[model samples]
Target: MAGPVHPARGVSYPVTALFMVGVFLLGAAFIASYVGGLHAPHPHRVPVAVAGPADATARVDAALRREGDAFDLRTYPTTASARQAIQHRDVYGAYLPQQGRLLITSAFGPTTSGLLRSAFAPVAAADGLRLSVQDVVPADPGDPEGLVPFYLVIGWIVSAYLVAAIVGLYRGMAAITLRDALVRLAAFAVYSAVAGAMGTLIVETGYGYLPDSPWPLTGVGALCVFAVAAATAAAESLLGIIGTALTILVFVVLGNPSAGGPWPLPLLPAFWRTAGPWLPNWAGTEAVRNAVYFDGHALTRPLLVLAAYAAAGIVLFLLLAGRTNPVMRFPAHSTA
Candidate 1:
C-alpha cells in the first residue's frame, strides 16, 4: 500500500520562490524595455509629400517650415505619386492640391504620424487649406492600434525559452546526444507549426487578442517560432540555465522595444534602435510586417539571419553531443 503524499511534500517552497523571483526579474526587464522605450522622448524627422505645381509646392513647404522643424518636405506631381512614396516608406505623410486632402500613414509609428500632423497644421492655417486624413496602408483590423505582431512574436519568444528551461530542469547540465538533438529539433518543428496556425487564427479571427494578416501570415509565424526555438535550444545547450535568462533578456527586453513595432526604429534611442536588427525579435517582426503589408519584399535578409541561427545551432549541438566527456561520481556512504 502507498502512503498519501501531501501536495507540497516533495517541493521546496524557497526554491520555487527564488525561481519565481528570477522570472519576475525577467518580466520586469521586459516591461522596463517596453515602457521605457515608449516613455523616452524622440523628435521625428519624417519625410512628407507635397503635391502640386512648383509654386504651390514651394508655398506649402515654406508654410510647413513655419510649423517648426518637423518635416522633410518633398514635391510630387500628383497625389498618386505621393501615395507611392508613403507605401515605399520614403515619406510619412502626403498632401494633395485638390481640396488639400491630407494622406497620413500608419506605415510609420504614431510619433512620426503626429509630427506630420503638427507640420501640416501651420501649412493649413497659412493657406486656409481644409484637411482630410486617409490611411493608404491601414493597419489590420484584427490588429487594431497595430500591436498584434509585436505581441505575437513576444509570445513565441517566451514559449521557446520556457520549453528550454523546463527541459533543463529535468535533464540538468548534460551534453545532448545526436538522438536527443534530433528529438528536440523535431519538437521545435511541431511547435513552430502549431504556433504559426495559432498566430494566423488570432490575426484573422475577431479574437481581439491579435491583429489581422493578409497572406503568408502563417508561414511568417512558423519561421518566427523556429528562429526563437532554435536560438533558445542552442543557448541552453551552450550555457545551461544562465543562457535561458539571457535569451529572454536579449529577445524580449532589448529586442522587442528596439524593433520597429510600437515605434519606428527612428523614434527609439540610438542605442536600442541600432541593436534591434541584430536580434531575433526584430527579424521576426520585420518578416511579419513584410508578409502582412509589404508584399513580402523586405523579409529576405532577416530570414537569412534566422536560418543561419538555426543551422549553427544544429551543427553545434551535433558536435557537442558526439563527445563523451568524463562524469564525476561520488562514492556511496557505508553503514558500519
Candidate 2:
C-alpha cells in the first residue's frame, strides 16, 4: 500500500505535467506550421520575360494570364535582352516566341527550372512547336539541388544564437559590465571570422560545390554570422533569459518559413513573400548566390540590411550596459 502524498509533492506532479504539455505543444506547432506553409507551393506572380513580335507577345501574355496568374510578364525587344534579364536576376525565365526556346537559370534552383519548364511546355505545345529549354546558369555539380546557400545560412544563424546564449549563460545580464559586453563582442567577431573561413573551405574546396572564390564567400559568411550574433547578444542584454526565447521566435519560427530557401519568394503565400526580403535568412542566401553565380549583381541591398542589423544590435548592447552601471563623474572644482 502507498503512503499519503505530501502537499508539495502532489502540487509538483501537476506542474511537471503542465510543463511537459507545453513543450509538446511547442514542438507540434513548429512542425505543423512549417509543413502547412510548404506542403503545396503555387506561383503567384513569378516574373518571366518574352521577346518576339507584338502579336506573339500579346498571345503569350494572354495565355499566361489564363494559366491562373502564374507569371508577371515583361516584354523585351530581343531574345538577347531577355537572356540578359535572366542573368541579371530580373526574371527567373525568358521565352523566345519565334524560336520556341525557353531560357532559365538552374543556378537559382533545379526545382524552379523544372517548374518553369512545366509551365511553358504547354504554351509551346499549343503552337505545335516543341519547347527547347536552355539553362543559362546551372547549379554547381556538387550541389545539384541548389540548396547549399540555404543550408549555409542556417548554419551561421544557429551558431550565432548558440554562441550568444552560451555567453549570456556564463555571465548573467545583471552582472555584465560594459567591458564584459565589449569582450563578448570581440569574441563573437573572432568566432565569426573563423567560422566563415571554415565554412567556405568546406563548401568550396572540400565538397567542390560553390564555384565562387573563397574570399567573397567568406566575407559574406562573416558578415552574416556577426549580424546574427550581435542582434542575439543585444536581445539577451535587454530581456534576460526571455531574450533567448525571443531569438528563437524571430530566427526559427518566422524567419525560416519566409526565407525563400526551398521555394523562391514569388511562389510563397502573401505573408511569407512580403516578409522574405526583410529577414536575414533570405538576405544571406541571396547574397551568397549572387557572389557565386551572378557576378555579385544585386548584392548591395542585402549587405546594407545586414549592416543595419549589426549596428542596431551593437548600439542597443552599449545602451543597456550604460544603464546597468552609470559612470561616476568627478566635480571640476576638486583637484587631486
Candidate 3:
C-alpha cells in the first residue's frame, strides 16, 4: 500500500524528531526563565549615598543591613558631596541628615526611587527628622517610567533577528558561499542603519521623548541592531535553523527578562542582576538610556560590547560560510 522509502527521507527522521524535542525543551525553558526570573523581584545590593560623619553613617548602615544585604551604603562627609556622587552616577539616591531630605534620581527608574523612599522613611522617623523628597534627575515627563529607551532597544533587537531570518532564508541557511555571506553582512549593515533611523524618528515624533538626542540614539540603535543581526547570521551559517533558535535561547529567553528594563538591576534577583550587564539587551537599553538621560556618561563599555559581538560574528561567518552543517545533511545509506 505504501511506496518504498527513500534513503534520504528515512535517514533524516531522527534529526527532525530531535528538532521537535529541542523546541519542547525551549518552551519549557522559556516558562522557567521568564516566570521564574521575574515573579518576585526585590532589591539586592542597591548602592545609595548617606551624608554624615563616620559614626552616623555606620549607624545608618547597621540599620539597612539589619533588613538585608539590600543597600550598599556609601558615605559622604556632606550633603553636597553626596549629591555630587548621584550626579556622577556613583549612587542612586542620597540621604542628607541635616537637610532632612532624600535626593533620588527617578531617571534611573521609578522603582528604584520608590524603594529608596520606603527604605529611608523609617530611618528618618528614628532620627526624629521629617523626610522631604527631591528628584535630582527625574524621568522625562513624556516618558514617566523611563521605559521608552528599553522598548526602543527591544525594537532594534527584534528587527535584527528578522533581518537574519529573511536573509538566511533567501540565501539558503543549509549552505552559504563566501559571496553570499559578504552580501548578507552588507545587507545587515544597511538594514540596521535604516531601521535605527526610522526607529529614532518614530520615537522622537510620536512620544516627543528623548529630545535633543536623535544622532546618538540612532547610533546606539544601529550598533545594537547590527551586533544582533550579524551574530544571528553567523549562527545560521554554522548550524542552519537550529542556530537561529540558539540565539533566541541566548538573546531572548535569557537576555530579555534579565535585561533590567522593567526595573533597575538592583531590584532584580542575584542571577539576573549578575547576568544583566553582559547581554546585548541590557547594553542597548543602558546605552539608549545614557544617551537620553545622563548626557552619554559611562557609554563606552556598552558600545565596546556591541562592537565585540559584531566583530566576532563577522569573523565566524567568514570562516564558516560555505560549510554545510552536518546536522542539515541527509546522506543516503545502503540496506544490508
Candidate 4:
C-alpha cells in the first residue's frame, strides 16, 4: 500500500475553500439583486397632491394619466392641505396650479423631487407660467442628496452582524450555556447603545448633517443595531458559520437593494418595492429620516419591526443556547 495517503489541497484548506466559494456566490447574488431591483425605474401610480383651479389641476392630472397613469392625483381643497400631506409622506409632490409652484420634499427623495420638476415644469409652461419648485422638507444642506441617514443605518447594520459573526467564530457559534447567552445579549445591548450614540455624535455634533433631535435617531439606531445583531446571533446558534453567510444574504444582498436607499420606492422594481419596507435597512432608514426631517410622523412601523426582530432573536438564542460550530472547530494540521 502507498505509505500513507494524504488529503488533497481542497480538503486540507476546507475553511478557505468554503469561504471562497461562499464569497463568490454572495458576490453574484449581490450583483443580481441590485441590478434586478434598480435596472428599470418605471414609476407608476406615484401619489401626488394637486391643488388650485380645477381646470389647471385637471390639465396636469390628465397629462399624468396620459403618461400611463404615472401619477395618482388627490385633489386637496387648499395648498395648505397638500403641504400637510407632503409632510405626512402621503404624497411625493404637490402642484399648485394657480400659484404655478410645485412643492416637493427632497427629504422624501431627491430623485422624486426631480421627477416632479420635470413633470410640472412643462405643464406650467404650457399655460404661459413659470413653475417654481420649492422643497418643503428639503434635504439637509450638508446631505443634499438625503443619503447620509441611509448610509448611517447601513453602517450600524453591517457592524451589528459582523459583531455577531466574529464573536461566534471565535468563541463558538452558540453560547456555552444559558447564562452565556444572556450575557451575550446584555453585552450587545450596551454595544448597541454606544453605537447609536456614536452615530448621532458623528452626524449631529461632528458635521451637523441632520440638525434635528438626536434622541430619536439614537433610539432608532440602538434598536436597529440590536435587532440585526440578535437576529444574526440567533441564526449562528443553530447553523454555525453558514449562518453568517445567510445573514449577509438577507441583510446585504437582498436588504440593501430592497432598502429604498439607493433608489426611491416608486423608482424601484415591483419586487424590491414590495420587499423594501420589511427589512431592517428600510425600517432604519425610514425611521432615521422620520426623526431628522419628518419629526417622527411615521415611526411606529419601523420601531415595531425592529422590536419584533430583537425580541424574537433574543428568545430564540436563549432557547437554542449551547451548540458546537461545525465549520469553525479547527482540526489540527500536524500529521502524526
Q: Indicate which candidate wins on lDDT.
A: 4
Residue 271 C-alpha lDDT in model 2: 75
Which parts of model 1 are misplaced by more than 4 Å?
Answer: 1-32, 52-78, 97-99, 107-112, 172-175, 206-215, 322-336
Kindly indicate the candidate among 2 and 4 with the higher lDDT.
Answer: 4
Candidate 2, residues 1-336: lDDT per residue as tens digits? 556544343345665676577567667766865776577788988999999999989988988988788789999999889988987889999988887889998876777889889988888888888999998888887777788988988898888889887877666542357887788789989998988898899888888889557998898889888998888888877776557767776777677777878888888887778887887888888999988888888899889978887899888887787444222111223222
What is each predicted model's overall lDDT from 0 to 1? 0.69, 0.81, 0.84, 0.86
lDDT of 2: 0.81
Question: For residues 65-172, could you state the per-residue lDDT of candidate 4 as single tens digits?
Answer: 767867888999899999999888788889998878999988855677888898888888887899998888988888877799889999999989999888887677
Question: Cα miss at 301, model 3 (Å)?
Answer: 2.0
Ordering by lDDT: 4, 3, 2, 1
Comparison by TM-score, 1 against 4, better one: 4
Task: Report residue 119 deviation for candidate 4 (angstroms).
Answer: 0.8
What's model 3's TM-score? 0.90
Winner on TM-score (1 vs 3): 3
In model 2, the runs with Cα more than 4 Å from the true position are 1-25, 322-336
Q: Model 4, 331: alpha-carbon shift in Å?
A: 3.7
TM-score of 2: 0.88
Better of 1 and 2 by lDDT: 2
Give per-residue lDDT, candidate 4, residue 285.
Answer: 90
